[model samples]
Target: MFRFFLLSIVCLITIPGFAQFPESKPEDEPFLDIGVALRFNYNLSTWKEDQLERGGDFGFDIFRINVLAAYKGIKLNAEYRHYAEGFGGGMLKQGWFQYDFSEASQIQVGLNQVPFGIQQYNSNNWFFNMTYYVGFEDDHDMGIKYIRDTGRWKWQAAYYKSAEDLVFSAAEGSPDRYSYDILGRNKENNQLDFKVVRRLGDSLAHELGISTQGGLLYNLDTEENGTRYAGAIHYEYKTGHSLWNIKLQAMFYRINPEYAPGNNLNFVEMGAYGANYNVANKGEIYTAGIAYHIPLETRLLQGITLYNNYGYYNKRVSGFENSHMNVLGALWTAGPMYIYTDAAFGYNQPWLGPEWENAFTAGTPGDTDWHMRFNINLGYYF
Candidate 1:
């Protein structure tokens, strides 16, 4: 049987996909498939500031457990992951129950992906674009989502009660997660999202979409609610003959938060990957990326993709230094085995910069410098 997201790079910003990968649909009888994946990586990071560590290079990254079940029009999907110490021990990436309205429409209820920025992902590299850090790209929450796909257009609408509740709390969500979310002294609630994309062409497809999202940030300290909103315009060009994909996106976001006395409104705490850090209250992001899929069919090598993603964050805060990131990488797929090789460069990015506490919050603006990391990750699935 063909796997839904098995080893697919499009699952990077993984969701219990919405009947998008391949032409998958619920079969006549009850069916279940369970798979496990092991991943390891080698990295030479500048931020480590250690020659020996950089030279050592090789380490275990993470492992994943995934499940898919379907009966008639009802479907189920879930994935859990375990990472090395200090990053996040283990977490549920996503879990959702889906109901297909027809071949053209469906709904997902449970912990589902929030429709924003770009579909699946905006970047093809191992490390996604900078937007993933600030809870814009590939984010998930506790919600219900409706999706409709026409030959030429796709529409998505969702309402999230809040971010994923790790410890069953309403106040704060743990940061040990694959996708970013709002947390800390405030909680994200009553969030709504709408997105529509238009696809033009067959062999050479031009896709454009607009997305808008808004929510209330409930402050536990003051027992009141604040507001945050974002809007984005995204475009992509894919050519079957050339096997080239081009993507571009522009976004503007602002968080009008009401905090307790003495709290700064310029930046707020956003959490992910087992940590919480300051994120700028307002910013505009511009991103571009390109990928070429090489159709080389072989026993050992099934596919190859070369890509580069670049993002620039223009902070609205005065005198705050802007952020820049570029990831150039190649992906190789062979059956259930996949590999990625990347060289990532950044300035003021938490994952790439020296200071991690306030990189996105722009709290420590001038203290950051250029950093780079060379990484190779390999994954095998059963």
Candidate 2:
């Protein structure tokens, strides 16, 4: 059934309109662009206890294809992804339609990018930051969004039915990659996000935003609500063959869940198969990162970029030590392909430690705390 449904969408997206209803100028008739990407990676983790796997391992990462089209003032975007699990049972990562009102304003509807945090984030590494793990980054949802960009100030606002819903809904308790509000008898009540960005100068900018969400979890017999506020500052400079970018951001988020005394457990962090998810509270996350790009003259080397990111999460729960993560990485690009390598180390305090899958899960309070992992990603985009 899933395969048939996926094929149906392919047919709808690929087939041309059989009936013409209107005409447009040459520049507005229609245009389509498509691209594909294949990614492979190698991973090594110090927390892995498997003796036979102490060396390392490599495997196929993911395959993705995207389509973009525009006609008159309407635009369409969609993406399909296939992963190792379930083999060919593909998934629709994103699909949306946008309407342009002017050169500086537009509105999008459907499954669109959620305007929160620093959209793409400031990390050069692929794993990104912890906020991403908690649903504040690279997340999209069914919504309507309005975006405006003048010269000095930019504005974005969105209204979503829930944090998520898909063309194909997952079975109950099925593991998902992105986090969402847990619904009781229905989807998350509703979510809204608003942000404003100001250009400080030619090379600097700043942004401030807020997000509000509420829902219920009948299975857990709880009601959940959260509000998040964040701010970010960014700067970029380019000279000769060198380019540099720096970014810093901080966020404070709080979740309130209705609960009975002594029964205060609610899932968070998009529960994994064998992980705990009882920790949720007011917390602040701070991240700072810098990247330097170097131009290359060699035929096989297009450019090189070096970056490092530092992130700290402070939980509001008493006696919970702060979590810290640091990453340093580099990317080498050649034509349509790029190779990325990075080393990441972090500690997840006691309260949140057990929610993870690494050595942190085994550590007791007051233990020397840290875990490390190295990763390499190679991908081609065409």
Among the numbered candidates, top lDDT falls to 1
Candidate 2: misplaced stretches above 4 Å? Answer: 1-28, 51-54, 86-89, 166-173, 178-187, 203-242, 260-262, 265-279, 349-364
Error of 1 at 240 (Å): 5.9
In the range 315-370, model 2's lDDT, one tens digit per residue, is: 76655556778878888877767788888877773222223532122224476467
- List candidate 1 segments past 4 Å from native: 1-28, 51-54, 202-204, 239-242, 363-367
lDDT of each: 0.82, 0.58
Looking at model 2, residue 305 earns an lDDT score of 80
Location of the lowest summed lDDT over 10 successive residues in candidate 1: 12-21
- lDDT of prediction 2: 0.58
lDDT of 1 by residue, 317-342 (tens): 87667889999888887776778889
